[model samples]
Target: MAEINASDVMKLRKMSGQGMMDCKKALAETNGDLDEAMTLLRKKGLATMAKRADRSASEGKVTVKSSGKDTVLTSLCCETDFVAKNDDFKEVADKVADAALQAAPGSKLAEQEIEGKKVSELITELVSKTGEKTEIGDWAKMSEEENTVVGSYVHFNNKMGALVKIVCENPSEKLQKLADEVCMHIAAVKPMALNKESFDQEVIEKEREIAKEQMKDKPAQIIEKIVEGKINKMISENCLVNQKFVKNEEMTVEEAVKDAGGSKIAAFERVAIG
Candidate 1:
């Protein structure tokens, strides 16, 4: 048996982007042979993925699979965007998103299967074939029965993606237009929540403190009103539904959703490639 030194382990880690324990184990399994260790790690990833494969993937391609009110929008990531567009990569993405649709209600990634292979094993297979790392980044599953309608926005460069799930009544042309506008808004504004109530209490408190400091020198009688006004403004500015529409300033997102056709946004998703 050959001695596997620290440098050899580091080299393997750099080449594989695998965990330290995994790299060391691979080295021992291969009798300190670097090439053999790499191969071992690859095989190990496939086997391990088979058991706990439904992990949240952080990199890959963003794909949309929809049929009327039932839809699935997912982002599958690879070590590089180059591989993300590969035919094989796209095929895997389609399969996963399709699986997500066919998967049991409320089934998560770990529970879904793609073409007889576990989700994780499929990802490892792609990694092995493309010579790059791959994983699922994010996903949105919508159903009318669940009161969720999907609106997707794919970045012009195809490097990033986003999905917005709207819960509105009797979606009309205007509502569809509004949904599309909201998708654009998500691309631009990037709000943290839908409204003030959805904001973290600590975050709200922090902003309140900041506003209070800005009005500290004001008359005490007016300070309370000032703080209240600032808090409202801050919440409106940060919440997606409260902010004025980017395309039409006359209406806020909340109003737009309603006036567009008596509908309201239910949920949303977004993605970007590094």
Candidate 2:
């Protein structure tokens, strides 16, 4: 049997992100062949992932990247908060977001490449290093035309983020400020859609049904009126343009945009990690 030196073990650990003991064992098993040892470590990581496939990975970070008229948001989820906050983990998420932004709007980041390796492979290495189930949760991209402006906000803890694109004839400083405020509102309120028109009819009808069940004791006409009122209120709450502005409660977000300069939200995306 070939002898594995400490330097060889450290080199393998650095390359594979595996534990020192594991790297040493792999090196010994591979007769000090670094490439073969790396393959062995990756296989072990994949096996670990398979064994923990049923576990929940809700804790992670949301990363955002913007360039020109495009903004991308990506979520990298892990099994625990400690791993989520790790420097290596954050570096991986940032790189993934950057790659996703450069690719097509809805392209899968995992299928993309980073540093000559597929992102999925890098994630497997991360799992091997962190000993946790890790995966990408969401990837959203928003693009605007030349006459439009894009704004984004990432919450303090990096767990939530939002991006908004506003279409305006003239992109002035005030219009940009309004767009930023709307993006912040999205990060805070978490609206379901831009407006009532965009909401799913099926969801609205289901809400109406639930409201009818709750008010069954009332008169038929009264029940209809109450159900309509409830559905309208729900729409107002879930629609971004209908929700009251956070900075100025007196006006809705739509009103604020119009007051600022008649800008309208063209698109928006919000990503959160639980």
Candidate 3:
């Protein structure tokens, strides 16, 4: 066995966030090679994480990042609220979200490599530190198209977030600011879809069926009218543009967007950790 120095062990501990004993063991196992020791420690973390695969990670954090043209949101989950509040856990979530902003639009976050390390490997390192299951819960990326702007928000608790992409004949800083406010509304109001057209047809059919059941005692002619009213009400409540604005409840989100400068919602995505 190669002689392991205290300095090398401490450096490895700092690099891997592993305990001093584990770092020393890794260093001795790798023959005092720092790079090799790091690799070995990460492999150990990966193994530990696999053993914790069945554990529930119900508490987590949400992070958001944007590059003007692209916005990304990611949720990193852990087994407890204490881990979720740890500085290390928060740092890893921010790194994951930043990497997501730069990743290929359709790429999977866990599979993507950042600076030669797989994203899942990073999460595994965190799992080793916390001694609990940790993983990426959800990820979303929204890109700004021609004549469009992207905005994002992460809630104060860091447990909910949103991204919005808007299209306009005239995109300006004011419109971008509106996009941000809309993102907050999204996080709070939890709209199901952008509009009636973007909503799922299957869900709409189910809603119609539900309405029919609720009014079975009514005449058939009145039932259609009642169903129409119910469907319209559903659109007003569940659709993003049609829903009442969270900032000012008197106006719909659609009206808010238009009042901001005739911008339309191109896309929106929300992420939450429970």
Candidate 4:
């Protein structure tokens, strides 16, 4: 077997993005062969992921990467905030986002590869280093086309964000600005759905049931009106288009979208982790 020097281990660390000890061990196993060490590291990642399969990974960052007229939102979730904040974890997440962006729209992000390694393999490597569960979470991709505007926002903490695409007769800087503002609004408001039509029907019925119970003492006619009023108010608050505009309280997001180029919010997705 060849000698494994400190420099060779460091080189493997850079190449595999695994921890120092892992790099050293891989080098030893590979007889100081850099390429073989990298392969060993990736294979180890799979075992590590399987070992920690039951761990709950609830924390991480949402990455919104944009290139030209396209944008991809991807999240890397880990077992704790400490691991989520780790520099290596963040770098891997960014790489995943980049790979997702490069792949065809709607591609399964975990299947995408860097060099010869699948993204899922890369994540398992980090799981081994951190001793924490790590996996990809919510993701979305958007490609802008004629007569449309795209906007996206990732909160300062990077734990939550939104991406929005709007349709207009003629896209412009002004409309784009509104779309950006709406993305921020989405981050702040965290709407449940684009509109009431899309809101979960069972949830809607449940709300109506709750309202009926609350007003059960009133006359049937009065109770009926009160229940409907409460349901409408609840829908308005939860639906994205019906929710009050976060920037200007005077209008609903629907009105705001209309005011900016007589447009409609064509598509949106909000991604978050806790």
Could you say which candidate leads in TM-score?
2
Q: Which candidate tops lDDT?
A: 2
Stretches of candidate 2 exceeding 4 Å from the true structure = none
lDDT of 3: 0.86
lDDT of all predictions = 0.72, 0.88, 0.86, 0.86
- Tens-place lDDT per residue, model 2, 92-184, is 998888788778977788899878988999988888788889999877888878878787888888888888888888888988888878878
The candidates, ranked best first by lDDT, are 2, 3, 4, 1
Error of 1 at 75 (Å): 1.3
Decoy 1 TM-score against native: 0.67
Query: Which digits, one per residue and each the tens of the lDDT, describe model 3 over residues 54-91?
Result: 98888899987777677789999988999999999998
Ranked by TM-score, the better of candidates 1 and 3 is 3
- 2 against 3, candidate with superior TM-score: 2
Candidate 3: regions farther than 4 A off: 28-40, 219-221
Which residue pairs collide in model 2, if any?
none
TM-score (C-alpha) between model 4 and the true structure: 0.87
- Per-model root-mean-square deviation over C-alphas: 8.8, 1.6, 2.2, 2.5
lDDT: worst 10-residue window of model 1: 49-58
* Candidate 4 residue-wise lDDT, 191-260, digit = tens: 9888877888898899999999989999987998999999888888888998889989899988998898
